[model samples]
Target: MFSTGSDDVGVRKAFFGSLVFETVEKTNGATSITTGIDNPVPIVILFVVLTIVFTMMQIIYRGLKQRRDELLKMSGS
Candidate 1:
């Protein structure tokens, strides 16, 4: 507990021209443990990609089905 540079319960300037304050104080400690959902960006991106892929797949499937029906009708006629 070596006190240095005018640490007698008041503000003082150090060698590098920095202000230092020393005081006696007390207060009730306030600590908390917080819980939250983390890394949400990747999950959201994954869902978005899945949605886009499924939508495109459905569009392609419907187009192919329509093309097949058209060909079938032409062949029958």
Candidate 2:
């Protein structure tokens, strides 16, 4: 279990499952508690997006390098 330094929030992981708990205060001096199981869907989406971005960057870099080499060769001739 991990506490966020306050007694109001905590996170815990066991085996392949994760749990999150939070406390919220209302303006009327009342408090609300919220609990949920953490989802890996957002992590998966972020990983996929980062992979696509890096792949595109690599492809663009290689293409630019190849084009530069071709230009250099033409100028040398």
Candidate 3:
């Protein structure tokens, strides 16, 4: 005979199985959440490349400014 409350062992077993099923459902939901997560590597690479390019550009600009300053000082500007 089966009873439908926690006082009965069978009901406790059923409730445990339901909890396990719910956990599997949540795991599958997480899998779908990451479906598009794999494509961002290229975007990350592009961001890093742009950062390096901008850093180099800033260094070049500073170097040109220093050279212009020296040239002005030599020409009495």
Q: Distance (Å) between predicted and true CA of 52, model 3?
A: 0.4
Best by TM-score: 2
Clashing residue pairs found in predicted model 3:
none
For candidate 1, give the lDDT.
Answer: 0.57
Q: How good is model 2 by TM-score?
A: 0.58
Model 3 lDDT, full chain set? 0.51
lDDT of 1 by residue, 15-73 (tens): 33333333432354432222333345655777899999999999999999999999999
For model 3, how does the per-residue alpha-carbon lDDT over 1-77 read when each residue is reduced to its tens digit? 13333432221223323221111124444311111232455667778999999999999999999999999999995
Looking at model 2, residue 18 earns an lDDT score of: 47
Candidate 1 lDDT score at position 51: 100
Whole-model Cα lDDT per candidate? 0.57, 0.70, 0.51
Descending-lDDT candidate ranking = 2, 1, 3
Task: Tell me which residue pairs clash in candidate 2.
Answer: none
RMSD of 2: 9.0
